[model samples]
Target: MTGPLDIHTARRRYITVCVLFWLPLGLSIAPLILLFTERGMALAAIAGFFAAHSLTASALELPTGGLSDVLGRRAVLAAAGLLNLVALTLVGLGSAPWLLGLGMALMGAGRALSSGPAEAWYVDTVQEHSGLDAELRTGLARGSSATSAALATGTLLGGALPWLLGLGPDLGALVSEATSELVLPLSVPILLGAAVEIAFVAYVLTALRERPRPAATLRDVLRGIPATIVGGLRLGGRDALVRRVFLSAGATGSALAAVELLTPGRAAALTGASESGAVLFAALACAGFVCAGIGSHLAPLTARLANSGERAVMVSLGASASGLLLLGATAAFAGVASLVLATIGYGLIYLGLGAAGPSENDLLHRRVSRSGRATALSVQSLAQQLVGALTGLIIGVLPSGPAPWLLGGSMLLAGTFLWIRRSGPASPTEAATPQPHTASSSPSAVGSGPLQQHADQ
Candidate 1:
């Protein structure tokens, strides 16, 4: 009999869950910023909140990821959704810094708990139906598209809602009404998000079925951690291609984070617009999301056109670097035309990056063993976070106008380096063909042909 965890069903569920999860996150950003401003919080304090949350989340990621290996993906993800519901609720209600910090920490924990497991679940489920190669690109594309759509919708609503509510207030009552309006509109998504998450948890409980975990002691689980970490590191270290992929991913992530941190300020300066300029920039950001969503949906075609996964990634990175360069130029020159061109460039680059995401992820999965997958992924995640944090700190301390130029230049250099290092000419083993999928076959029966062929040579 065909398994319940078919790729088509799983993909739909994955997209649904992503939309629900991201809507709240998207909505929360504006409120979080407003709250920070309202309280007269320092940049350092805001940075501290993010840093503390990331540090704690990083600590838990590995352990919980391992737990997913032992306990199963569905259980872990359901728990994560519930945790996010609580955390988002707290964030909406919080007025004090300590309370906000607590909420942020909880949010981080929820993110940590959810991050690797959902992907793992998708891959595992899809592989059961269609095998890895068939599902990998399409699955990632669908998920990315869903996430981008969620962000665009949430941001548009978040940016517009305050103004909509602020319109009706009488002159004497306007200030109080506006403040109250601000809180509710921003908080609405989070409340709705909680309900969506609960629904997702229920869906997962009913829909997802996987192989039961093998009997193991708590000691057994703990003992696997060291070996798992060592195995992941060894696999990446020994393989030049894998090492380059990690480096490229880390660099790209760092560059993207730097852009996100600096872009709004740059846009405001270039346009000579006040804080209200943020709304326009926010709209631009939503446009970028739409671009990314479209690009991800068309990733398969892009990958084919590029000839190889490595080349696709290079194209993506190169586009992003170019976009950043344009952004820097626009900021320096300060013209409306330049601003429009820069936004267009940035959106296109984001699209390319989204296109490359799935292929890169598939390459990682192909190279690593199932037992070490989450650990390997966690290492990559940690590297990206570390690099992003460092980039943010450096930008903050230096405070140079040319910082965007430097960051863009660095991304270009990194992408060029990876392109040069491309695992030249796949061996006969490396070029092994993927197997076709059929609905009647079990996952294990579907295809070991390609992987086995690759391993043999």
Candidate 2:
């Protein structure tokens, strides 16, 4: 990592990191619920497991982000990978309720630690090589695309592995017998994911080079993080554009929560059995990831087409909202047409979010300086995660059917509207946003007179 790399090399490394980290999560998705059930866990217990994951991630988001800022990207990322390695292995092998729960909480901690470090590292590297006005959209978008592609590929493979093993003399049964029922067919994906985590950690340690931060004592590291955290917290309040971006992140979260909660049951209903429903859902999930990858790949073009990052976000989010609305509008129907529309709606949800993410982040990166970059990204993630959790709760309590879809769509629409008024001084003719003053402090120091002028303009 000490060796100098061109921006192309940096971006390629970043994309690879994205794929390596995200693919494992994707692999676990297809078999996770079934695995829990196979272990004799009820719906409530399964929900508790997920709640543990979310709660742990939510609680650690800021601290972990600050950890990255205070420590360095490579170390934090490697730690995250190691945590995920242990977490996935434990989840794969452990049968007891507490073991599984602890595994999930560890997984969440891994997730929180992994969130923004790689991207932050890339951004930092680009600035070092290309100066202050480095082009970040392409790298960010490519990273998003790589992540989506990994998920899609992993979904297909993970979903197929168990079935493939089940056929031809039932290798899965043989494995179960050999392992004394400790490792089921469904557990293979997770075990494979754990192996991948090892690779992810190794790659991150070697590929994501960073200039080492000054070696600080534990107390100094501790003190610096809070100051950075406080600065990141104050960031959105001071910068109007940053605030809009965070709000938009929340809206995206709400929409995503609705989609994730509603889609599985809806698929189950359509297929008339949980097993078939799962297959259909896996296929749909894969397709959604593909669509998301395509959207991320096209994000730069989307910005150009819409004229500005602001407009692109609006258009992308609006498209997503419309998709949700379509789902809501067709909720009462029962036909192939309804199914097709629902499928399209699902794809659009991922696609729009994919496209919107890069554009919104492009706007965000311009305003925040180097110091609090990861912290800012973590805050953005926190906003999304916390809001998504709340949204899930709200959707759960609400009566089923179009109500959930409508709630999400309405919230996304409101977020879209935030961009319509153009709170920042983005030009109608240009796609890139104006950069902020690079004051060498945290984000609280980032938005002073210059950023105020940006809002006014």
Candidate 3:
């Protein structure tokens, strides 16, 4: 058997996987909506595409977690990468809205499949080797930073590529003609994303290996998955901390959905052309990712300053809500100043979220056992996706401009209060070490807790 994994090795692998997983998404983010419009899709049709992706992802989140838990992380991740490859290809090449929707569905499935496995694997490996109290915040922060950095790099390059191609030799036009307009200049980034998915698959296959579990038939997985899903669901109801985390995740999701749904159109209006807007949005996205990277890099320091993860999250939420409020307030103004304010507000929101995520996850890992790690993460992701779906619907009906941002800001402000007080004092073990023993585990970790009882039943 291989030797136990070291923390440094595990952390390095974790950050590497994070970069690989997120880079393709960053590459495609600049052009996805613009591409649909380029192909003659309407506002409602674009909304439907996003809704379809969200619904598919949300529906599969729990099941995919169970699948990862039962089947091991590497397999599920590789499967996701392969699926992403197909999805990106279709999206890059297809013009019909139905075809695009089909591609988006597959992409959502890939997202669901890939969601928790890498981080789960890292947490599991770390806890196994370093014990449950291992200092997770720094490593998690670094991973988050790496992800943001990848996105920033990808966005800048992807955004510039189309503009660059059109300028030099009119290469985009030649390519568009050659492919019968299936691969427009805007489509190049997504097609490039497909190439990166291939790399993701290869990396996962080679870099990740699970400790051997007892050999079991396919029957074992089939039976265990539903049970795991049930256990994951019970966590929110039974544990105060878990419930709060779910609530925080949902609120953040709503805020994000509003920004993403509204901001691109506003940007399109600002630039006065669909094509120019795509480029502008890409640059803005790059800046936002840079801000997020800075926030992630500062998370450990934030936790120290706040004196606890809970306070850190509260502070982060407040910052995000403040930014959203600013965004809402500036919506009516027109000109360079308003655009600059909007961009700053958008960057701040991302920055706060990036800072909050690692601290929040650090607490989550403290609460969960290795066995349920992926499932717990999945539950968190499910809350985000479900709330995001609802937020999209709400935004669809709302009047354009500040209303959606105001509503989202209000929700985020409410979430900030969830962590104002602790459920109880941290036990001696929890207080003393980064890793907590079972007796001193977060409220969610109580063995005889209601969630455990529900699991038994």
| RMSD, one per candidate, in order | 6.6, 4.6, 5.5
lDDT of 2 by residue, 1-457 (tens): 4655789999999999999999999999898888999999999999999999999999999988888877878999999999999999989998999999999999999999987788888887987898757888888899899999999989998889999999989999999999999999999999999999999999988788887666767766777677767767887887678888888888888888888889889889888998898899899889988888888889899999999888998999998899988898888799989978987888887888888888887787667666667777888889888788899989989998899999999999998898887764633112112223233222221222111000000
Superposition error at 120 for model 1 (Å): 1.4
Which pairs of residues have clashing backbones in candidate 3? 133-434, 133-435
The lDDT for every candidate, in the order shown, is 0.63, 0.82, 0.78
Two-way TM-score contest, 2 vs 3, winner: 2
Q: TM-score for candidate 3, please give it.
A: 0.89
Total clashing pairs in model 3: 2
- In model 2, the worst 10-residue window by lDDT is 448-457
Off by over 4 Å in 2: 1-4, 425-457
lDDT per residue as tens, model 3, 1-457:
2855889988998899888888888888777877888999999999898778878988898888877876778888999999889999989899988999999999999989987888878877887788867888888888888988988887876777787889968999999999889789999999998999999999989887668764546766766677667767876786687788888888888888878777778778888997677667667777777877888889899999999988998898889888988899898889889877887788888889888888888877776655566777788888877787788888889998789889888888888889898765433234222222232112112121211000000
Off by over 4 Å in 3: 40-45, 96-98, 180-182, 269-275, 334-341, 425-457
Model 1, 65: alpha-carbon shift in Å?
2.6
